[model samples]
Target: MFIQIAIYGLLIALFPLAIVWASKDSNKYRKLIAVTLFLTFDLIIFGAFTRLTDSGLGCPDWPGCYGQANPFQAHNEIKAAEALMPTGPVTVMKAWIEMIHRYLATCVGVLITAQMIIAWWRRSSLRHSPWLATTLFVLVLIQGAFGKWTVTMKLQPIIVTIHLLLALTLLSLLVWAWMRESPPLVVSVQAWLRRLLPIVFLVLLAQIALGGWVSTNYAALACHDYPSCNGEVIPDLDFEHAYVLWRELGKTASGDYLPHSALVTIQWVHRSFAWIVFLSLGLTAFLCRKHEVLRANSNAIIAVLLMQFLSGVATVYFSWPLAIAVLHNAGAALLVLLLSMLNYRARAST
Candidate 1:
């Protein structure tokens, strides 16, 4: 079973491998990195969609659906599962979504594996340390382990949140690796803004984790009102329950169904921290606007920041439409990507 899965993963990677081979550019490794990076981004977005649609358990198994490679092979078992729980997470559509996600993830892993081989093979000719490639390859393996836990553990909030964080972290590292391919930006900004970027980046990461916590706990719609939660300046909340990281997916540590107020608290904290990230990051971008090279990159973040905020509002106003919800997630990942670039440009050692 494992070998079949591994072969399926390699098969999925062939298309991208072929593209890199046919490219006229000599820097095929770098092109491969770029392609892998884009696919990683897509994987993160689809992960959001899968979670939002409650498709995480669509297959109810890891690496393969019903011990089969594709949905077609597992059709009868899926149909049986669906028959038992028609409105549950194992419908035919969701099985396909979950399996396809795993398949894409497999392709990503294979691409990174190939990168490790190439980096070591061509170590002398490379511009940057191949260690980053090796580290990313290791991280992908760790991420894959967590992917299995995400299933085996039945979507525990902490597990799911960490999975989301790891994916974003991977994306950030990839962006940093890609930046090494080009000349580092040397725009001189005041030391204060330079210092502020790292601070803002850390804060953004916390906010993302909180956002993930909210999503994992089904707290997105916990408070439907914006600027005010559930139309109250501060709705009643239960911090202890909400912040219990080790609890099961929808239950408390003692196996009770988690209270509604716990969900409220999760959403409240996430929404509150977002404003802090917005203001600090806004200032960081504003400081970069005067410098030419940094201006575009900074502006890209600001634009997405605004879009993310508005989409956040739309999420509440529109009651969490699928398209907007998925876009909100992609926006967060994009914010991380651009900010990583901004930081790399500022501190990269030439």
Candidate 2:
């Protein structure tokens, strides 16, 4: 079973592997980094789809489906569960979603393994520190462990949110790695602005965490309309239930039916944080426009931010459409990538 699963993983990774190998540029290492980053981005998007579709527990087990390698072999068990409860978590559609997510994740693992091997082999000639790549490899391994625990632990809110955060962190590191290899064009800006980049990055990271919390807690629909939640300036919010760190996915700490107010609290907090994120990004973009080298990236960042904001609003107004939800996630990741690249270029140019 394990061998079969391994083969499936390899198949998924083959295209990226080929691209990395066939590139004739002397900077093969940089190309490898780009490929890895792209794959990681896809993994994040698919992970979001898995969560939005309520397929997190499709397999109902860790690393494998019903102790079998793939859903094909475990079809009987999944069908049995679905037969008993037609709308239960384990069903044909959900099993595919869950298995596809795992397969993509495995392929990413393989790419990271290759990256580590190459970094070790070329450590002597490499311009950047190989230790960074090694560290990223280790982090991905830990992230994979948490991904398993997300399922085995029964989708505990804290664990799932952490899992999402780790994935974003991994994306940040890969973006850093890519920058180290082929530094972006240098920009001349105020010294204070340069320093602000890292601070903004930290703020964006926090906002991403809040967004993850809202998603994992299934609070997307907590607020039905814009500007106000449930037609109140400050709606009745159950902070006690909403902020409890350790609880099941949708339930409060006391095991009572979690009040709508709790969901409202989560949604409101996440929505409010969007303003902070938007203001920071806007400032960064304006500052970057002063430097010719960073002007293009700065524009791209603003465009993505606008798109992200629209998607966020649409997801809520449209009742959490799957396509928009996935795009919202992809937008967050792209923001991370663009910001990381800008910061790296600034530091290296200095």
Candidate 3:
């Protein structure tokens, strides 16, 4: 089963590999990085879709669906599960969704592996150290491990949240690697802004993690109203149970049904932190865009930040429509990408 799954991943990767090879661009390695980066972004987006659709446990197994290589092969078992619990986690459609997500992930792993191999094989000729790709390779492995735990652990909030964060982290590292190959189109910034870059990035990461926590806990609708959670300036909250971190889904650390107050706490914290992210990212991007050399990066950052802001608001006001929710996740991934590229430029300018 594992070998079959591996073959499927390699086959999925072949199409993109061919495109990179056939492109007129002389620098195939950089082209490969670009393609890998693109797929990783898509993987993150689809991952959001998978989670939002409650397909995380569609297969309820690791690396394969019901010990088979694809959903088609597992149809009988999946059908049985769906029949057993009509609205439960396992269904034919969901099995396909979950398996497709895994397949795309495998494809990405293959591409990253190819990157590490090429980076090391051509170490003398490459501009950056092979270590970057090596690190990516390692991170992807860890991400895969978490993916398994996401299923085995039954979508435990913390593990799943960490999985989402790791995906964004991998995306950020890929952007950094890709940006290293491109000419740095940035000028030296003031010391203050230089110092602020990492700080802002850290803030964004924290916000993303909080957002993941909200999503994993099904707290998006805990307070359906915007600007005010459930129409209160400060809603009743349960920080104690909300952040226990290692509890099962929808249950407290001691295994009681999680209270509404805990859910509100999760949503409220994520909602409140958005203000800080908006200011930090917005101010940094606003300042960086003033520099002609940094205009593109800064503009992309600002545009996505606004989109992220609006999508977040719309997700709340519209009651978390799937499209908007997925876009919100995509915006988070894009921010990670843009900020990572900016960070690389900031270091290069120094």
Q: Clashes in each model (backbone N, CA, C under 3 Å)?
A: 0, 0, 0
lDDT of each: 0.91, 0.88, 0.93
Superior by TM-score: candidate 1 or candidate 3 = 3
- In model 1, pairs of residues that clash are none
| Residue-level lDDT tens digits of model 1 in 1-350 | 66787888899899999999999977888889889999999999999999999999998988888999778999999999999999998999999899888888999999999999999998999997799999999999999999999988999999999999999999999888878886566667667777878899999999999999999999999998898998898999898799989989889889999999999999999999999999999988888888787889999999999999999999999999999999999999999999998998777622
Better of 1 and 2 by TM-score: 1
Most accurate candidate by TM-score: 3
Better of 2 and 3 by TM-score: 3
| Predicted candidate 3 versus true structure: per-residue lDDT over 172-263, tens digit per residue | 99998888888656487788887889999999999999999999999999998889998898999899999999999999999999999999
Report the lDDT tens digits of candidate 2 across residue range 1-350: 66777678888888888887898968888898889899899899889999989999999997889998888899999999999988888998999899899988888888888888888898898886678888888998899899999999888889988998899889989988887787456456678887999999999998898898899888999899987888986888778888899888778888877788888998998989899999998889878888888888899999999999999999988999999999999999899989988887777665
Please give the distance, in angstroms, between residue 120's alpha carbon in candidate 3 and its true position after superposition.
0.8
TM-score on alpha carbons, each prediction: 0.97, 0.96, 0.98
On a 0 to 100 scale, what is the lDDT of residue 175 in model 3?
92
Candidate 1: lDDT of 332? 98
Clashing pairs in 2: none
Tell me the deviation in Å of residue 198 in model 3. 0.7
